[model samples]
Target: MVTLRNAGLSLTPRNIDTQSLSLISWNTDGFSSRPVSRASLILDHILEGPKSPDIIFLQEVTPFVRAFLLKDARVRAAFLATDAEDQTGLFEDVPFLTMTLVSSERFADSLHSQKQGQGVQGGEDCMLGRVARVTLPSKYKRDALCVDVVSPTAPGAFFRLINVHLDSLGDTLHYRAQQIEILANVLHEPGCSGGIIAGDFNAISPEDDGLIDKNGLVDA
Candidate 1:
């Protein structure tokens, strides 16, 4: 039995006055018997409830669940998703993938005017790009889904918002570590203002502590 965990990551740069960026990540077990229903319940609570977030990251999303999320009235109106494209060629062999949804309202007109390189009220051109998968060595064919979103706090600055589902179980601890290292390198790339990585780590060993810590990441 897998436990579902919803994690929150807060972005706060010291000394700079910036509004809070609320983000939520959850691993929706797409293999479950009622994937769509389970996903709907989670969406209803997160989107309609008081804690409506600025960004939503979902992992283990199947084609069926992804379709429901994209077509949902509220989600379509409120968020711009990364998995809107036909992923058959890219994800045909993969049973599930990850997705990132950015709030259209929060990014202002940038999302709609992305092609023109228009600015959001507080920044230069801001846009949310398509998901880029980082292949990981694992029997499960796991990968990290990365989205580049303009930083709300820093004008013209962007951060790699990654939705990752690491290789599971205790035996794959080394694989998980390698996955984190690959992601950490992306965070430090030129022109990037760091990043926020979130998803199901499937931690089951004492060694799991170093997987994140050695990569200079903190649990949020």
Candidate 2:
């Protein structure tokens, strides 16, 4: 299968009058194998521009990245749902897809709560008034962080933010479909206003249609 080998940055923006609420999704590959640490590079890319996304959804967070986030004063102030503080697993590889959620300092107060996902899927739900994460199912332990957030761009409305990282094996598509089914149930939670699911799904083909519309989900 032709999985998403490299990485991607997906941003969804909504306009409310003159303001906009934008959410960013990215897979960092843990920066495990690299010549130079690219954490700062990614951070600069996210923070340099005025039109930066208000929230960031990250995947494959590593211990090194976690340390940097803890040490950096700016990142510390940004308010995040990272495993930087989690030491439950002493092993080097805590979890392959330890998803993290980040929000601009300006909206620090906007964060409501962070909770783990259902069953054995060790993911999180970063709650932001209008948009919130509900639940998920990842058989291979491919974690996803769900968010309940109020789109700043759409003042009075709410939506869900799902930061997902699916299995990369050959049989990934099958499991991905199952994950989507669980996601459908997640989207039905009371305050959900139709949200976006972004991440590295490890899709097999470029022409592959998600068939998500049947579940009230469409590719963004």
Candidate 3:
């Protein structure tokens, strides 16, 4: 089970002053699960260095890898949305486990899974997907994770951070459309004033209009 702490993250506002908060996302290619030389690249570039990003979004994180990242003190908050749980870690399904997100101010505040259905898993689900969301398709359980934070830049002002991992290698155009619809819905929900949505988008730009123009979010 995932947990949430009552702590708050202090952030730098993009207005008035230079933004202290920065975001970085990467596809580890199963770094945490494999735990090897490539993993060291992450360590050397981000985790071990002093100039680390304030917010981190990682993709292709295996359950084992996410579990390992959770233990590190640098992760301020983690929103890990995974495919269906597999406690055994015996099956190494690549598409079955295409994406997940983790956040850290270098410790943890809270972590939560973003919704699917209107959302996208990697792609397998998209290929066998709904006809106008009537009946759900077979799912690989990909996810979008959301995190909330209050910034020192504007104390008491709250904002949301969203991490996404889209379909890897399938009928991405249609699949991304459906997924963006769900993502747009999440952004438009009441009390959702503003937020950052970042991750692996397998599709091209035209498909992003709904998530942008329709939803009132401009590219950052």
Candidate 4:
């Protein structure tokens, strides 16, 4: 009955010939009484680094937490976030959502698309990408949040990073597979080299082991 709070960060070198990436995953329970405080600690840990991650994945992000992150001077200086703008009240009705934040230093020189939005000045220039919410068929009304980033290893190429909070609880087990399938389809979409899907899968079943491989994605 223990549910994991999920979050992750992926880091790749700017010019190294090696193709390695670093990832950190965490899920902050937005419903907790101290959501902002907890989130602040997590952010502090991520930023205080000998090894700062290039991309950050956050799940169950409440509006307050989102605003706090976007406004934090340190956070805004260090990373470009998917939730940088709340124009049009897109996230107003939702209780919580997922977000992706990429390192401004790493992507500072990379090519950016119109969908990623203009850079904001926060010590460093950060091109905050627009996050797309992919609807799910679950009764819980879950959806995946995603953003595109320029591949550090492959210059001029891009890949997608998806953050998801799948349906939870044993009663919703069937919906987990459907959720995986839908996201797996996104990985296979043309015009990108590949993608990484990470977050709270709510994996409580044995069948979850084979789900990623079945969809042509190897567990990392």
Candidate 5:
């Protein structure tokens, strides 16, 4: 496992030219209610760059925003969690649409799945979203969407991307520690490879007195 240290490195962007693929990850903080607009802005930023990324890992995005992106032809693929509280089944529709666009031609064997548990009081909503290959992997498989992303340019190289958003409220120190533990275990599991654990950690600073120590995380 690779640990990104908070210090000892200059703040310039690392040169990724030698890398076959680049993955972008971020937490959208969906509950804020501006997901649609925020998504648009993010897309703009990504596109503004000279190069496009091969994969994007986003957390805390609502079903509504995912659906909106799927409607656009430019979105090559998407994997998101279903809001459990959406008993009307409206939440599942977005992924279904995205699959129609990406599954056949591009991410032919991609998969998707959601973490168990409802976000809201009703079963209609869920807090954590995950999506993996439509087909399952041979090892270390779970309900979470765990898939291998093979770079088109580099056949033998691959990585695992785990998107997460830990508990944001209550005893933050305790919660962050638990999150680090969970992430470490997941990464250590069999068949796991080098990957980034990206999401809303809610920890503002590395020295924030309350931060927990796990492995491989760099506070920035």
Candidate 6:
């Protein structure tokens, strides 16, 4: 494993051989309002090493941020969803970066089998995207981001990758839970077999009793 530290944060990259497939997921804490200085800091961290991740699942990024990152030749591909909008009329201009990536051909084909629908009651407008060097065959397409990845050592076995950003904010727990259930159902449906789900869950760590702190606070 390779470890790098920056801005008081440390990231350890697991040394899975090049032959092994890998995926990365992270939440950018609402990329819309992040200052350029902070953004640059993050960009530096992402670009610092010889390592380039095959798939990245990022949440809370604006269109501007997405465009900035895409400018890097190493990015290869990207996707974004439309949930960054707010109901209170605030942040009308921030771009939903992840949604844009989902529009790409590589990501769309994987989700072809699933039903396409609009924003769920409590869930953020969510979408998925995928990127790789080779073009995935048409028949394997789905409405969600899907990609065909093959490990030379393990030829026949393939996996689908998914990115999801569940709901956050007040009274959204029920909505988030429902969304998770829906996702589970989709996974169980015929043809949608096993795959990796990545993205910001917006969930707090469980407490000592292993119970989620639904109240959003810890006892003092």
**For model 5, what is the alpha-carbon lDDT of residue 40?**
77
Which 10 residues in a row give candidate 4 its minimum summed lDDT?
Answer: 119-128
Ranking by lDDT: 1, 4, 2, 3, 5, 6
Stretches of model 6 off by over 4 angstroms after superposition: 1-19, 35-37, 76-158, 205-220
Residues 8-96 of candidate 4: C-alpha lDDT, one tens digit per residue:
43433233234445556678788899999999999888778787777677888888898898899987777766636444565666788
Q: Global CA lDDT of candidate 4, please?
A: 0.66
Q: Candidate 3, residues 46-159: lDDT per residue as tens digits?
A: 656555555566666655555565554444233333332333542344432333333323323223322332322221111111101111112344556655444334433334
Give the Cα lDDT of each candidate. Answer: 0.71, 0.53, 0.45, 0.66, 0.42, 0.38
Worst 10 residues of 3 by lDDT: 125-134
For candidate 2, write residues 150-174 as lDDT tens digits: 5444545555667777666665666
Question: TM-score of each candidate?
Answer: 0.82, 0.69, 0.57, 0.79, 0.56, 0.51
lDDT of 3 at 86: 39
On residues 1-220, what C-alpha lDDT tens digit does candidate 6 reach at each position? 1111111221221221233333455556554456445655665675476654434556565555655555644443433232322224223543342322332322333322323431111112112322321111222111223332323233333334445565555455555555444444444444332444455544543322121133221211
Task: Name the top lDDT candidate.
Answer: 1
Residue 190 in model 6: lDDT:
46
Greater TM-score among 2 and 3 belongs to: 2
Residue ranges of candidate 5 with Cα displaced over 4 Å: 2-19, 77-108, 112-145, 150-158, 205-213, 216-220
* Candidate 4 similarity to native, TM-score: 0.79
**Residue 141 C-alpha lDDT in model 1:** 88
Q: How many backbone clashes does candidate 3 have?
A: 9
Q: How many clashes would you count in candidate 1? A: 0
Task: Give the count of colliding residue pairs in each prediction.
Answer: 0, 10, 9, 9, 16, 20
Q: In TM-score terms, which candidate is top?
A: 1
